[model samples]
Target: MVATTLRSIKSLVPLLDRVLVQRVKAEAKTASGLFLPESSVKELNEARVLAVGPGGLDKDGKRLPMGVSQGDRVLIPQYGGAPVKVGEEEFTLFRDSEILAKINE
Candidate 1:
């Protein structure tokens, strides 16, 4: 059976066409060929730009500029965010200001 998904309402603070995201994968295995379980892995300090919201207001009461685009992976704090669940995956949302840096590779 297929599962249905829910989309979030337009953000109140305005994403300016940007959505902050935290990945669900907590642990990665080492090169020893041994697999590490979720409980054994250390959480990484990273995130990604998941979705883009509506455009921001322009100087004349219209939308302004957007700081990020889709598929852009970024880094964020370990704490300070709201929990969200999309289908079986869980993620967090942070304001653009909360983003520390962007990852190109």
Candidate 2:
């Protein structure tokens, strides 16, 4: 997995109600300290928010507040979201509404 930093993706920003995030890599080893084979490692549906777009407009033409902000850990769906690449790092773009939940941890 590529290492991502705020400086590397500083130029890219989501437009409206879109969020940019980097997927959290799944652990290759189990709690027992045994290294698992590539096929056994399942991809996690968790990600770190890198950037967020300005809130979308409401029915009254006023801007609504975004649910999540940068640096927030969130739960995403298994599928969907547009894939984005910055330098060697890979990221995903999802609509704010598409984020399943915000992780407290």
Candidate 3:
């Protein structure tokens, strides 16, 4: 798979059940309209699916379809994804089974 800059993440293509994800930045302001300090802003466990790999082969050698697709919003684990760096951009890589859930919105 090609490592891509965050701005150019769209061009990345994952391989073998891998998934490319861009984390959603924490909100700058709260519901009450209070601006949070940079240090206080918590990173969210949410991310947008940037790219997906072709399904891995099964024991029978048949390709398994991925549960998530490109552009899907998903809930990721708080930790455990492999960190990916590209031209000052940060992203994460996870296996298809590692994805927690798909968000409807």
Candidate 4:
């Protein structure tokens, strides 16, 4: 038999009813090929779901299903998400109930 190595890795796992997401970056250039200045570029309230927590518990101790899942695109509020950073990338965590809406496209 071949030797198998088991390693413990650290990763971000959101708690109950929480969802991890990365903001969708805004375009730096306009349709007419003009580059917008940093001050003029506005941050969007949109993000992509990276991970989701196992749903919250109900009054009877039953687990409720999460509305969003990994790889989903959603709308977030202008404020109130907890910021997180992994390596050189930045992410945010929001409660499932706080996610504004899912983007169909």
| Overall lDDT per candidate, in order of appearance | 0.63, 0.89, 0.88, 0.85
* TM-scores for every candidate against the unseen true structure: 0.66, 0.83, 0.83, 0.83
TM-score of the candidate numbered 2? 0.83
Q: Against the true structure, candidate 2 has what lDDT?
A: 0.89
lDDT of 2 by residue, 1-105 (tens): 334455677787898899999999999999999999999999999999999999888999887889999999999999999887666778998999999999996
**Which segments of model 1 are wrong by more than 4 Å?**
1-18, 24-27, 55-60
User: Which sections of candidate 4 miss by over 4 Å?
Assistant: 1-10
Best by lDDT: 2
In candidate 4, position 62 carries an lDDT of 89
Q: Give every collision pair in model 3.
A: none
lDDT of 3: 0.88
- Considering lDDT, which of the candidate structures 1 and 4 is the better prediction for this target? 4
lDDT of 3 by residue, 1-105 (tens): 346446666666888899999999998899999999998999899999999999889999888999999999999998787888788778899999999999997
lDDT of 1 by residue, 44-87 (tens): 77776676566656678786555666667877777786666656
What ranking of all candidate models by TM-score puts the best one first?
A: 3, 4, 2, 1
Q: What local lDDT does model 3 show for residue 16?
A: 89
